[model samples]
Target: MAAALLGGGDYELQVSLSEALCRLTPRKDREQRTNQWFSSRDVSRAFCDIQDRDFEVDCRHFLNYVNRCHGDQRRVHTFPCLRAFLDSTELFPPKDEKLEKFWVDFNQTSECLSFFTDDPQVPSLT
Candidate 1:
């Protein structure tokens, strides 16, 4: 995250990771176990690919954002990369552990699409 930015990791990858961050986030107790498991797996995979030197730092940054936004329905600004995403999406229906929305906004709507996939031929975490 912030510290990793200093290491000059792949920008697009970080952006995608940020996007995956949003997608993988679960809707708390209300979130479906199946979806959570799948999304977690996908997110973890992408996260793991980051350089080992930066993984721990980035993970800490990502988790900090998550923790900062905890209990926040909108979950806005959970990551630095989320700013652009937030502006492009619809502003309604704040997301929560009970509501999973990815289309409308980072954490506002529960319509997240599967992102990272192990195989191109296979569908992602849906």
Candidate 2:
């Protein structure tokens, strides 16, 4: 499951896995069978649309996807994009100690948007 997610394979497969997990655990609600099917083009369109400045549109699209899947289902595979969106919007639970540690590690490892040093024409801010 992790491999499929990391490899960017069929996202529906991930959603199916999540549904299976939910069935096994029996969360608050049963698995929703909404239009869970998505093609690569659909994903691409969603990816582009999410970048829109209108938060309402973005949130609606995101919630539509989430609602299509069973909420609180352990087996439901959450896309990394959803996780990122939730994190950035502070929509999820409050960040705990572990989350804080994750942020620290992520910030340390990820690249920052800084000016390149090779541009000789531009004066160095430092």
Candidate 3:
């Protein structure tokens, strides 16, 4: 995914996580004010802000981090059909609210090549 996103130098949108957060928050003015550049600490801070304080999405702690709510597992469970799998995260929400923003941003991103849909708790038979 990272390779594909960065592989093509043709990016339609170039914004940082914080800036995206700001825009989602209805603060586009602030988004333009901040620089797009991010340091390691900034990345860490953004990750922490998105995840539960106790959770960390890093290589070292990732296994334990998503133990309860795995992205891959959620995709499979929530999106059994190919369309659902590729279409939404309603079937696979983060464990909490902080994670929701991350999911929303992810779904809205062209890079992820996914979409946002009303994710009913239970997958539909139809």
Candidate 4:
């Protein structure tokens, strides 16, 4: 099973499988799952070690998902993922200002505090 290979210590396979899983996920639940995967500490750290091509694929998927989330009026739950990615990536800030602006606006919204303040009611997907 592909899930079993996740612990095989293969970075390339991990990246591929992670992307494939997200792509194959049902549309109705894709956003939450995608956010969970990227926000996972181990997965996020492993992504930083993958090849450029694989990294780009993951980045593209995240960007597309964010766009869809916004257009569908869905809440964005990948702030931790984005933060981790930014921390892992060196120099050369993201060119997309929209993403930056969205984060800024999103922070002003009431739900932003939940991301920092841990609540027992908010179940973590990770």
| lDDT at 5, model 2 | 26
Cα displacement (Å) at residue 97, model 4: 11
- Tens-digit lDDT track of model 1 for 17-37: 454544455334223432433
Worst 10 residues of 2 by lDDT: 100-109
lDDT of candidate 1 at residue 83, scale 0 to 100:
20
RMSD of 1: 15.5
- Candidates in order, TM-scores: namely 0.21, 0.21, 0.20, 0.26
> TM-score of predicted model 4?
0.26
Highest TM-score against the true fold, candidate? 4
1-126: candidate 4 lDDT, tens digit per residue? 233323323333333565566456655665455446564554444433333355444443443343333454433323323332235542232445322321211322234422221233455699
Clashing pairs in 2: 18-75, 18-76
lDDT of 4: 0.38
Q: Give the per-residue Cα lDDT of candidate 3 at 82.
A: 29
Residues 1-126 of candidate 2: C-alpha lDDT, one tens digit per residue: 323322322334433444343344323222222113333444434423432244333433443353334344322232222222333432232333322211101111122211101223455579
Better of 2 and 3 by TM-score: 2
TM-score of 3: 0.20
Every candidate's lDDT = 0.36, 0.31, 0.31, 0.38
